[model samples]
Target: MADPQEPRMTAKRFHARPGVEDWRVLFWGAHAFYAADSLTHAVALASAVAEIADGLDHHPDLDVRPHGVTIRTRTRRGGGLGPLDAELARRVQEFARGEGYRPDPSTLMVTGIAVAQDRDADVRPFWAAIMGYEPLDDADAVDPQRRNPHVWVHELTPPKPGRGRTHIDLSVPADHAKARVEAALAAGGRLVSASPEGWTIASPDNHGVDIAIWPDFEDFGEDG
Candidate 1:
Protein backbone atom coordinates (compact mmCIF):
# COMPACT_ATOMS: atom_id res chain seq x y z
CA MET A 1 0.00 0.00 0.00
CA ALA A 2 1.15 3.51 -0.69
CA ASP A 3 2.02 5.71 2.27
CA PRO A 4 -0.96 7.76 3.35
CA GLN A 5 1.40 10.67 3.94
CA GLU A 6 2.85 10.61 0.46
CA PRO A 7 3.03 14.02 -1.18
CA ARG A 8 0.30 15.07 -3.55
CA MET A 9 0.69 13.81 -7.08
CA THR A 10 2.13 16.25 -9.57
CA ALA A 11 -0.10 17.63 -12.35
CA LYS A 12 2.05 15.92 -14.98
CA ARG A 13 1.74 12.51 -13.26
CA PHE A 14 -1.99 12.97 -12.76
CA HIS A 15 -2.44 13.68 -16.48
CA ALA A 16 -0.37 10.64 -17.39
CA ARG A 17 -2.83 8.06 -16.09
CA PRO A 18 -3.53 5.19 -18.49
CA GLY A 19 -7.11 5.89 -19.59
CA VAL A 20 -7.22 9.54 -18.66
CA GLU A 21 -6.64 10.69 -22.23
CA ASP A 22 -9.95 9.11 -23.18
CA TRP A 23 -11.78 10.87 -20.36
CA ARG A 24 -12.63 14.57 -20.15
CA VAL A 25 -10.67 15.04 -16.95
CA LEU A 26 -9.10 18.48 -16.52
CA PHE A 27 -6.22 19.16 -14.17
CA TRP A 28 -6.55 22.29 -12.04
CA GLY A 29 -3.75 22.37 -9.52
CA ALA A 30 -4.45 19.67 -6.91
CA HIS A 31 -7.98 19.09 -8.14
CA ALA A 32 -9.49 17.42 -11.22
CA PHE A 33 -12.83 18.40 -12.77
CA TYR A 34 -15.16 16.06 -14.70
CA ALA A 35 -18.49 16.93 -16.28
CA ALA A 36 -21.50 14.70 -16.94
CA ASP A 37 -24.61 15.23 -19.04
CA SER A 38 -28.10 15.72 -17.63
CA LEU A 39 -29.29 15.82 -14.06
CA THR A 40 -30.67 12.28 -14.11
CA HIS A 41 -27.41 10.93 -15.44
CA ALA A 42 -25.54 13.05 -12.92
CA VAL A 43 -27.65 11.75 -10.06
CA ALA A 44 -27.10 8.18 -11.12
CA LEU A 45 -23.41 8.71 -11.49
CA ALA A 46 -23.29 10.42 -8.13
CA SER A 47 -24.95 7.43 -6.54
CA ALA A 48 -22.38 5.08 -7.97
CA VAL A 49 -19.62 7.49 -7.04
CA ALA A 50 -20.94 7.69 -3.50
CA GLU A 51 -20.83 3.93 -3.12
CA ILE A 52 -17.34 3.67 -4.49
CA ALA A 53 -16.16 6.61 -2.43
CA ASP A 54 -17.59 5.03 0.70
CA GLY A 55 -15.74 1.82 -0.02
CA LEU A 56 -12.50 3.73 -0.51
CA ASP A 57 -13.22 6.41 2.08
CA HIS A 58 -12.59 9.11 -0.54
CA HIS A 59 -15.14 11.65 -1.67
CA PRO A 60 -15.19 14.33 -4.36
CA ASP A 61 -17.07 17.60 -4.40
CA LEU A 62 -20.14 17.09 -6.57
CA ASP A 63 -22.40 19.73 -8.15
CA VAL A 64 -25.41 18.31 -9.95
CA ARG A 65 -27.47 20.65 -12.09
CA PRO A 66 -30.31 20.49 -14.58
CA HIS A 67 -27.98 20.53 -17.57
CA GLY A 68 -24.91 18.76 -16.19
CA VAL A 69 -22.89 17.56 -13.23
CA THR A 70 -19.45 18.72 -12.20
CA ILE A 71 -17.07 16.51 -10.21
CA ARG A 72 -14.00 17.89 -8.42
CA THR A 73 -11.61 15.49 -6.72
CA ARG A 74 -8.68 16.24 -4.45
CA THR A 75 -7.03 14.74 -1.42
CA ARG A 76 -7.50 17.03 1.54
CA ARG A 77 -5.15 14.93 3.63
CA GLY A 78 -2.37 15.39 1.08
CA GLY A 79 -3.51 18.91 0.36
CA GLY A 80 -3.80 18.10 -3.34
CA LEU A 81 -4.29 15.39 -5.94
CA GLY A 82 -2.88 11.93 -5.22
CA PRO A 83 -3.09 8.29 -6.26
CA LEU A 84 -6.45 8.00 -4.55
CA ASP A 85 -7.89 10.78 -6.69
CA ALA A 86 -6.46 9.24 -9.82
CA GLU A 87 -7.93 5.83 -9.02
CA LEU A 88 -11.33 7.28 -8.27
CA ALA A 89 -11.27 9.34 -11.47
CA ARG A 90 -10.43 6.29 -13.51
CA ARG A 91 -13.31 4.37 -12.03
CA VAL A 92 -15.69 7.30 -12.57
CA GLN A 93 -14.62 7.62 -16.18
CA GLU A 94 -15.16 3.94 -16.86
CA PHE A 95 -18.56 3.97 -15.22
CA ALA A 96 -19.63 7.20 -16.90
CA ARG A 97 -18.54 5.88 -20.28
CA GLY A 98 -20.43 2.64 -19.82
CA GLU A 99 -23.53 4.59 -18.84
CA GLY A 100 -23.38 6.65 -22.07
CA TYR A 101 -22.58 9.86 -20.24
CA ARG A 102 -20.06 11.47 -22.56
CA PRO A 103 -17.45 13.82 -21.19
CA ASP A 104 -18.04 17.50 -22.08
CA PRO A 105 -15.13 19.86 -21.65
CA SER A 106 -17.24 22.95 -22.33
CA THR A 107 -19.20 22.21 -19.19
CA LEU A 108 -16.05 22.69 -17.16
CA MET A 109 -15.69 26.33 -18.17
CA VAL A 110 -15.79 28.94 -15.36
CA THR A 111 -16.01 32.71 -15.75
CA GLY A 112 -14.49 35.47 -13.65
CA ILE A 113 -14.31 39.22 -14.02
CA ALA A 114 -10.88 40.89 -13.87
CA VAL A 115 -10.44 44.55 -13.05
CA ALA A 116 -7.10 46.31 -13.49
CA GLN A 117 -6.66 49.11 -10.98
CA ASP A 118 -3.90 51.05 -9.30
CA ARG A 119 -5.32 50.14 -5.90
CA ASP A 120 -7.35 46.98 -5.54
CA ALA A 121 -8.34 47.92 -2.01
CA ASP A 122 -10.19 50.98 -3.29
CA VAL A 123 -12.67 49.05 -5.46
CA ARG A 124 -12.68 45.54 -3.96
CA PRO A 125 -15.16 46.32 -1.22
CA PHE A 126 -17.56 48.16 -3.50
CA TRP A 127 -17.70 45.30 -5.98
CA ALA A 128 -18.02 42.75 -3.19
CA ALA A 129 -20.88 44.60 -1.57
CA ILE A 130 -22.77 45.09 -4.82
CA MET A 131 -22.29 41.49 -5.85
CA GLY A 132 -23.01 40.12 -2.41
CA TYR A 133 -19.82 38.09 -2.66
CA GLU A 134 -17.50 37.32 0.20
CA PRO A 135 -13.85 38.35 0.10
CA LEU A 136 -11.33 35.57 -0.38
CA ASP A 137 -7.99 35.74 1.45
CA ASP A 138 -6.27 37.03 -1.69
CA ALA A 139 -8.77 39.94 -1.85
CA ASP A 140 -10.76 38.43 -4.71
CA ALA A 141 -14.51 38.11 -4.34
CA VAL A 142 -16.80 35.26 -5.32
CA ASP A 143 -20.58 34.96 -5.41
CA PRO A 144 -21.99 33.95 -2.06
CA GLN A 145 -24.16 31.41 -3.84
CA ARG A 146 -21.26 30.36 -6.08
CA ARG A 147 -23.60 30.90 -9.02
CA ASN A 148 -21.94 34.00 -10.45
CA PRO A 149 -18.46 34.42 -11.85
CA HIS A 150 -15.70 35.60 -9.51
CA VAL A 151 -14.43 39.21 -9.53
CA TRP A 152 -10.62 39.51 -9.43
CA VAL A 153 -8.89 42.87 -9.01
CA HIS A 154 -5.34 42.94 -10.34
CA GLU A 155 -3.18 45.98 -9.60
CA LEU A 156 -1.61 47.73 -12.59
CA THR A 157 1.19 50.28 -12.39
CA PRO A 158 -0.28 53.09 -14.54
CA PRO A 159 -3.25 51.24 -15.95
CA LYS A 160 -4.02 50.98 -19.66
CA PRO A 161 -6.04 53.25 -21.94
CA GLY A 162 -9.43 52.62 -23.65
CA ARG A 163 -12.43 50.63 -22.36
CA GLY A 164 -10.19 47.70 -21.53
CA ARG A 165 -9.46 48.03 -17.85
CA THR A 166 -12.03 45.32 -17.17
CA HIS A 167 -12.25 41.98 -18.95
CA ILE A 168 -13.77 38.55 -18.65
CA ASP A 169 -11.68 35.54 -17.71
CA LEU A 170 -12.97 32.21 -18.93
CA SER A 171 -11.25 29.28 -17.26
CA VAL A 172 -11.32 26.06 -19.26
CA PRO A 173 -9.50 22.75 -19.23
CA ALA A 174 -6.06 22.93 -20.78
CA ASP A 175 -7.00 20.30 -23.30
CA HIS A 176 -9.97 22.36 -24.43
CA ALA A 177 -8.17 25.69 -24.63
CA LYS A 178 -7.43 25.56 -28.37
CA ALA A 179 -10.91 24.46 -29.34
CA ARG A 180 -12.56 27.15 -27.23
CA VAL A 181 -10.28 29.79 -28.69
CA GLU A 182 -11.02 28.62 -32.20
CA ALA A 183 -14.74 28.66 -31.54
CA ALA A 184 -14.51 32.20 -30.28
CA LEU A 185 -12.43 33.21 -33.28
CA ALA A 186 -14.93 31.69 -35.67
CA ALA A 187 -17.64 33.71 -33.99
CA GLY A 188 -15.98 37.00 -34.96
CA GLY A 189 -13.75 37.34 -31.92
CA ARG A 190 -10.06 38.00 -32.63
CA LEU A 191 -7.06 36.59 -30.83
CA VAL A 192 -5.18 39.34 -29.04
CA SER A 193 -2.43 37.24 -27.54
CA ALA A 194 -1.47 33.70 -26.51
CA SER A 195 0.46 32.06 -23.71
CA PRO A 196 0.89 28.62 -22.17
CA GLU A 197 -1.71 29.61 -19.63
CA GLY A 198 -4.33 30.51 -22.31
CA TRP A 199 -5.38 32.95 -25.04
CA THR A 200 -6.62 36.50 -24.85
CA ILE A 201 -9.57 37.03 -27.22
CA ALA A 202 -11.02 40.37 -28.19
CA SER A 203 -14.46 41.25 -29.39
CA PRO A 204 -14.95 43.18 -32.61
CA ASP A 205 -15.81 46.20 -30.47
CA ASN A 206 -12.41 45.85 -28.68
CA HIS A 207 -13.49 44.28 -25.42
CA GLY A 208 -11.07 41.59 -24.19
CA VAL A 209 -11.71 38.19 -22.65
CA ASP A 210 -9.15 35.62 -21.56
CA ILE A 211 -9.54 31.92 -22.20
CA ALA A 212 -7.21 30.22 -19.79
CA ILE A 213 -6.48 26.95 -18.10
CA TRP A 214 -7.21 26.93 -14.42
CA PRO A 215 -4.11 28.23 -12.62
CA ASP A 216 -2.11 25.61 -10.76
CA PHE A 217 -1.70 27.78 -7.67
CA GLU A 218 -4.68 30.15 -7.70
CA ASP A 219 -7.90 29.02 -6.08
CA PHE A 220 -10.50 30.66 -8.39
CA GLY A 221 -13.30 29.48 -6.13
CA GLU A 222 -15.68 26.51 -5.92
CA ASP A 223 -18.37 25.59 -8.44
CA GLY A 224 -22.04 25.57 -7.62
Candidate 2:
Protein backbone atom coordinates (compact mmCIF):
# COMPACT_ATOMS: atom_id res chain seq x y z
CA MET A 1 0.00 0.00 0.00
CA ALA A 2 1.12 3.58 -0.63
CA ASP A 3 2.03 5.64 2.39
CA PRO A 4 -0.50 8.28 3.31
CA GLN A 5 2.26 10.74 4.15
CA GLU A 6 3.54 10.75 0.58
CA PRO A 7 3.23 14.39 -0.33
CA ARG A 8 3.62 14.31 -4.08
CA MET A 9 2.90 12.04 -7.01
CA THR A 10 5.28 12.44 -9.90
CA ALA A 11 4.03 12.69 -13.49
CA LYS A 12 5.22 9.17 -14.28
CA ARG A 13 3.32 7.60 -11.42
CA PHE A 14 0.21 9.62 -12.16
CA HIS A 15 0.20 8.58 -15.78
CA ALA A 16 0.79 4.92 -15.03
CA ARG A 17 -2.53 4.58 -13.29
CA PRO A 18 -5.56 3.07 -14.98
CA GLY A 19 -9.00 4.66 -15.35
CA VAL A 20 -7.45 8.13 -15.51
CA GLU A 21 -7.61 8.24 -19.29
CA ASP A 22 -9.72 11.34 -18.99
CA TRP A 23 -6.96 13.27 -17.18
CA ARG A 24 -3.65 14.50 -18.53
CA VAL A 25 -0.87 16.28 -16.70
CA LEU A 26 -0.32 19.77 -18.08
CA PHE A 27 1.81 22.55 -16.68
CA TRP A 28 1.42 22.27 -12.92
CA GLY A 29 -1.72 20.21 -12.75
CA ALA A 30 -3.68 17.27 -14.09
CA HIS A 31 -6.43 18.47 -16.41
CA ALA A 32 -9.58 16.86 -17.80
CA PHE A 33 -12.22 18.26 -20.12
CA TYR A 34 -15.77 17.00 -20.51
CA ALA A 35 -17.92 18.16 -23.39
CA ALA A 36 -21.54 19.04 -22.82
CA ASP A 37 -24.25 19.34 -25.46
CA SER A 38 -25.46 22.63 -24.04
CA LEU A 39 -24.56 25.44 -21.65
CA THR A 40 -27.01 24.05 -19.11
CA HIS A 41 -25.28 20.70 -19.34
CA ALA A 42 -21.89 22.27 -18.83
CA VAL A 43 -22.98 24.10 -15.67
CA ALA A 44 -24.52 21.01 -14.16
CA LEU A 45 -21.39 19.02 -14.97
CA ALA A 46 -19.27 21.71 -13.36
CA SER A 47 -21.47 21.55 -10.27
CA ALA A 48 -20.98 17.82 -10.06
CA VAL A 49 -17.23 18.19 -10.33
CA ALA A 50 -17.40 20.88 -7.64
CA GLU A 51 -19.05 18.44 -5.30
CA ILE A 52 -16.38 15.83 -5.99
CA ALA A 53 -13.67 18.35 -5.17
CA ASP A 54 -15.49 19.45 -2.06
CA GLY A 55 -15.95 15.92 -0.86
CA LEU A 56 -12.25 15.30 -1.24
CA ASP A 57 -11.36 18.69 0.22
CA HIS A 58 -9.03 19.08 -2.72
CA HIS A 59 -10.54 21.55 -5.10
CA PRO A 60 -9.51 21.83 -8.73
CA ASP A 61 -9.55 24.81 -11.06
CA LEU A 62 -12.82 24.74 -12.97
CA ASP A 63 -13.64 26.40 -16.27
CA VAL A 64 -17.18 26.08 -17.55
CA ARG A 65 -17.46 26.98 -21.20
CA PRO A 66 -20.53 26.89 -23.40
CA HIS A 67 -19.67 23.40 -24.59
CA GLY A 68 -17.56 21.86 -21.85
CA VAL A 69 -16.22 21.90 -18.34
CA THR A 70 -12.47 21.83 -17.80
CA ILE A 71 -11.13 20.79 -14.41
CA ARG A 72 -7.52 20.88 -13.26
CA THR A 73 -6.15 19.37 -10.06
CA ARG A 74 -2.84 19.46 -8.21
CA THR A 75 -1.24 19.52 -4.78
CA ARG A 76 -0.72 23.19 -4.09
CA ARG A 77 1.09 22.55 -0.82
CA GLY A 78 3.67 20.11 -2.14
CA GLY A 79 3.79 21.75 -5.55
CA GLY A 80 2.63 18.67 -7.52
CA LEU A 81 0.06 15.89 -7.63
CA GLY A 82 -1.41 14.50 -4.44
CA PRO A 83 -3.41 11.37 -3.81
CA LEU A 84 -6.49 13.46 -3.33
CA ASP A 85 -6.12 14.79 -6.83
CA ALA A 86 -6.25 11.28 -8.25
CA GLU A 87 -9.29 10.60 -6.15
CA LEU A 88 -10.96 13.74 -7.43
CA ALA A 89 -10.17 12.75 -11.00
CA ARG A 90 -11.61 9.29 -10.50
CA ARG A 91 -14.78 10.67 -9.04
CA VAL A 92 -15.10 13.23 -11.80
CA GLN A 93 -14.73 10.50 -14.39
CA GLU A 94 -17.37 8.40 -12.67
CA PHE A 95 -19.82 11.27 -12.46
CA ALA A 96 -19.09 12.32 -16.01
CA ARG A 97 -19.95 8.86 -17.27
CA GLY A 98 -23.20 8.81 -15.34
CA GLU A 99 -24.08 12.30 -16.53
CA GLY A 100 -23.31 11.47 -20.18
CA TYR A 101 -20.52 14.00 -20.41
CA ARG A 102 -18.04 13.13 -23.11
CA PRO A 103 -14.40 13.07 -22.05
CA ASP A 104 -12.38 15.08 -24.51
CA PRO A 105 -8.71 14.29 -24.00
CA SER A 106 -7.38 15.60 -27.28
CA THR A 107 -8.14 19.21 -26.32
CA LEU A 108 -5.84 19.21 -23.27
CA MET A 109 -2.86 21.53 -23.71
CA VAL A 110 -0.57 24.02 -21.99
CA THR A 111 1.11 26.83 -23.87
CA GLY A 112 4.02 29.08 -22.90
CA ILE A 113 6.73 31.36 -24.22
CA ALA A 114 10.44 30.52 -24.12
CA VAL A 115 12.72 33.53 -24.33
CA ALA A 116 16.40 32.95 -24.97
CA GLN A 117 18.34 36.02 -23.97
CA ASP A 118 21.83 36.95 -22.82
CA ARG A 119 22.93 35.18 -19.66
CA ASP A 120 23.66 38.48 -17.93
CA ALA A 121 20.47 40.15 -19.13
CA ASP A 122 17.07 40.05 -17.45
CA VAL A 123 14.08 40.19 -19.80
CA ARG A 124 11.44 39.07 -17.33
CA PRO A 125 10.84 42.58 -16.05
CA PHE A 126 10.20 43.90 -19.53
CA TRP A 127 7.84 41.03 -20.38
CA ALA A 128 6.11 41.46 -17.04
CA ALA A 129 5.56 45.13 -17.79
CA ILE A 130 4.10 44.60 -21.24
CA MET A 131 2.19 41.35 -20.72
CA GLY A 132 0.80 42.41 -17.35
CA TYR A 133 2.31 39.23 -15.94
CA GLU A 134 3.68 38.89 -12.42
CA PRO A 135 7.20 37.63 -11.97
CA LEU A 136 7.17 34.12 -10.57
CA ASP A 137 10.92 33.92 -10.15
CA ASP A 138 14.20 35.39 -11.32
CA ALA A 139 13.64 33.90 -14.76
CA ASP A 140 9.89 33.35 -15.14
CA ALA A 141 6.56 35.11 -14.99
CA VAL A 142 2.89 34.27 -15.38
CA ASP A 143 -0.43 35.99 -15.96
CA PRO A 144 -2.25 36.79 -12.76
CA GLN A 145 -5.60 35.69 -14.22
CA ARG A 146 -4.05 32.57 -15.79
CA ARG A 147 -5.50 33.76 -19.09
CA ASN A 148 -2.18 33.84 -20.93
CA PRO A 149 0.85 31.65 -21.56
CA HIS A 150 3.68 31.57 -19.03
CA VAL A 151 7.00 33.26 -19.80
CA TRP A 152 10.21 31.33 -19.13
CA VAL A 153 13.47 33.23 -19.38
CA HIS A 154 16.20 30.89 -20.60
CA GLU A 155 19.70 32.33 -20.60
CA LEU A 156 21.79 31.96 -23.74
CA THR A 157 25.31 33.30 -24.06
CA PRO A 158 25.70 35.95 -26.80
CA PRO A 159 21.99 35.43 -27.42
CA LYS A 160 22.28 35.01 -31.17
CA PRO A 161 19.31 36.48 -33.00
CA GLY A 162 16.95 34.28 -35.08
CA ARG A 163 18.38 30.93 -34.01
CA GLY A 164 14.94 29.64 -33.22
CA ARG A 165 15.70 29.82 -29.50
CA THR A 166 12.82 32.12 -28.80
CA HIS A 167 9.53 30.50 -29.65
CA ILE A 168 6.14 29.34 -28.46
CA ASP A 169 6.00 26.09 -26.49
CA LEU A 170 2.82 24.07 -26.80
CA SER A 171 2.82 21.33 -24.19
CA VAL A 172 0.43 18.44 -24.63
CA PRO A 173 0.13 14.84 -23.56
CA ALA A 174 2.65 12.37 -24.97
CA ASP A 175 -0.02 10.76 -27.12
CA HIS A 176 -1.27 14.11 -28.36
CA ALA A 177 2.11 15.61 -29.25
CA LYS A 178 2.58 13.23 -32.17
CA ALA A 179 -0.73 14.26 -33.75
CA ARG A 180 0.12 17.92 -33.29
CA VAL A 181 3.44 17.41 -35.01
CA GLU A 182 1.82 15.43 -37.80
CA ALA A 183 -0.86 18.06 -38.34
CA ALA A 184 1.78 20.77 -38.45
CA LEU A 185 3.74 18.79 -41.01
CA ALA A 186 0.65 18.26 -43.16
CA ALA A 187 0.04 22.02 -43.02
CA GLY A 188 3.42 22.83 -44.64
CA GLY A 189 5.42 23.27 -41.44
CA ARG A 190 9.01 22.10 -41.42
CA LEU A 191 10.41 20.02 -38.61
CA VAL A 192 13.30 21.69 -36.82
CA SER A 193 13.95 18.91 -34.33
CA ALA A 194 12.36 15.93 -32.61
CA SER A 195 12.71 14.08 -29.30
CA PRO A 196 10.71 11.78 -27.07
CA GLU A 197 9.39 14.81 -25.23
CA GLY A 198 8.20 16.59 -28.40
CA TRP A 199 9.20 18.37 -31.57
CA THR A 200 10.09 21.84 -32.76
CA ILE A 201 8.53 22.89 -36.03
CA ALA A 202 8.72 25.99 -38.21
CA SER A 203 5.95 27.61 -40.17
CA PRO A 204 6.36 28.47 -43.84
CA ASP A 205 7.76 31.87 -42.88
CA ASN A 206 10.21 30.32 -40.37
CA HIS A 207 8.25 31.06 -37.21
CA GLY A 208 8.97 28.27 -34.71
CA VAL A 209 6.80 26.43 -32.21
CA ASP A 210 7.83 23.71 -29.78
CA ILE A 211 5.31 20.98 -29.13
CA ALA A 212 6.37 19.21 -25.94
CA ILE A 213 5.28 16.82 -23.23
CA TRP A 214 3.57 19.02 -20.67
CA PRO A 215 4.58 19.91 -17.13
CA ASP A 216 8.05 19.85 -18.64
CA PHE A 217 9.25 21.37 -15.42
CA GLU A 218 7.47 20.83 -12.13
CA ASP A 219 7.11 22.44 -8.71
CA PHE A 220 5.43 25.53 -10.15
CA GLY A 221 3.96 26.17 -6.69
CA GLU A 222 0.78 27.50 -8.24
CA ASP A 223 -2.23 27.59 -5.92
CA GLY A 224 -4.46 29.52 -8.27
Question: Which one is best on TM-score?
Answer: 2
Candidate 1 positional error at 59, Å? 3.5
Please report the TM-score between candidate 2 and the true structure. 0.86
Q: Please tell me which predicted candidate would have the highest lDDT against the true structure.
A: 2
Local accuracy of candidate 1 as per-residue lDDT tens digits, 1-224: 23555655655666777755433333322233345556776688788878878878887767776555667666642125668878887887787778776666555766789977664236788789999988875647877555577888887657544323789987676766788888889999998998777789999899999887744323332220
RMSD of 2: 4.3
Worst 10 residues of 1 by lDDT: 215-224
Off by over 4 Å in 1: 1-8, 22-39, 56-58, 65-67, 75-83, 160-164, 214-224
lDDT of 2 by residue, 8-72 (tens): 67766666666677888877578889998989999999888888877877788888999898888
Where model 2 places Cα greater than 4 Å from the true spot, the runs are 1-7, 77-79, 161-165, 214-224
